[model samples]
Target: MNNIRNWLMGILAGLATVFLTVGGVRYVMAGGEPGEVEKAKQAFKSAGIGYGLAALAPLVVTILRGIVGV
Candidate 1:
C-alpha cells in the first residue's frame, strides 16, 4: 500500500512535468496562429490541472487507504 502511494505520487508528478513541457513547447511554436494558440492554452490548462492533482496526491492516497481499510 505504501508502495502504491509512492508510485501514484511519482506518476502524477511526472505527468505534471510532461504537461508543463508540452505546454511550453506548444506556446512557443504557436507563432500567433489562432488555432495553435488555443491548443497551447488548453495544454497549459491541462498542465495546471496535472499540477493540482500532483499537489493533492497525498490526500488522495490517504482517502483511498481509508476507503480500502488499509
Candidate 2:
C-alpha cells in the first residue's frame, strides 16, 4: 500500500510538472494576442491547480489513512 501510494504520488507530481511546463510555454508563446492570452491564462491556472493538488495529495492520503486506520 505504501508503495502504491508512492507510485501514485510520483505519477501525479510528474503530470503536474508537465502541465506546468506546457502552460508556461503556451503563455510565453501567446505573443500578445488577447484571445490566445486568455487561453494561455486559463491553461496556466489549470496547471497551478494541478500542482497544488499534487502537492496536497500526500497530506490527503495520510489523513485518509489515519481515518481508515490503514
Candidate 3:
C-alpha cells in the first residue's frame, strides 16, 4: 500500500509538472494575442489546480485511510 501510494503521488506530481511546463510554454508563445493569452492563462490555472491537488493527495489519502481503518 505504501508503494502504491508513493507511485500515485509520483505520477500526480509528474503530471502537474508537465502541465506547468506546457502552460508556461504556451504563455511564452502567445506573442501578445489576447485570445491566445487568455487560453494560456487558463492552462496556467489548470496547472495550478493540478499542483494543488497533487500537493494535497498525500494528506487526503492519509485521511481516507484513517477513516476506513486502513
Which candidate should be chosen as best, given TM-score against the real structure? 1
Candidate 2, residues 8-36, lDDT tens digits: the string is 77877787777777767877888988887
Residue 53 C-alpha lDDT in model 2:
76
Per-residue lDDT for 17-57 in model 3, tens only?
88788878888998998988888888778878877877887
Q: TM-score each candidate.
A: 0.87, 0.73, 0.81
Model 1 spans with C-alpha error above 4 angstroms: none
Candidates by TM-score, descending order? 1, 3, 2
lDDT of 1 at 60: 86
lDDT (0 to 1) per candidate? 0.84, 0.77, 0.81
**Model 3 scores what on Cα lDDT?**
0.81
Model 2 misplaced stretches (Cα beyond 4 Å): none
For model 1, residues 1-70, the per-residue Cα lDDT tens digits are 7687678778878888888888789889989998988988898888788878878878888998899898
| Ordering by lDDT | 1, 3, 2
**Clash pairs for candidate 3:** none
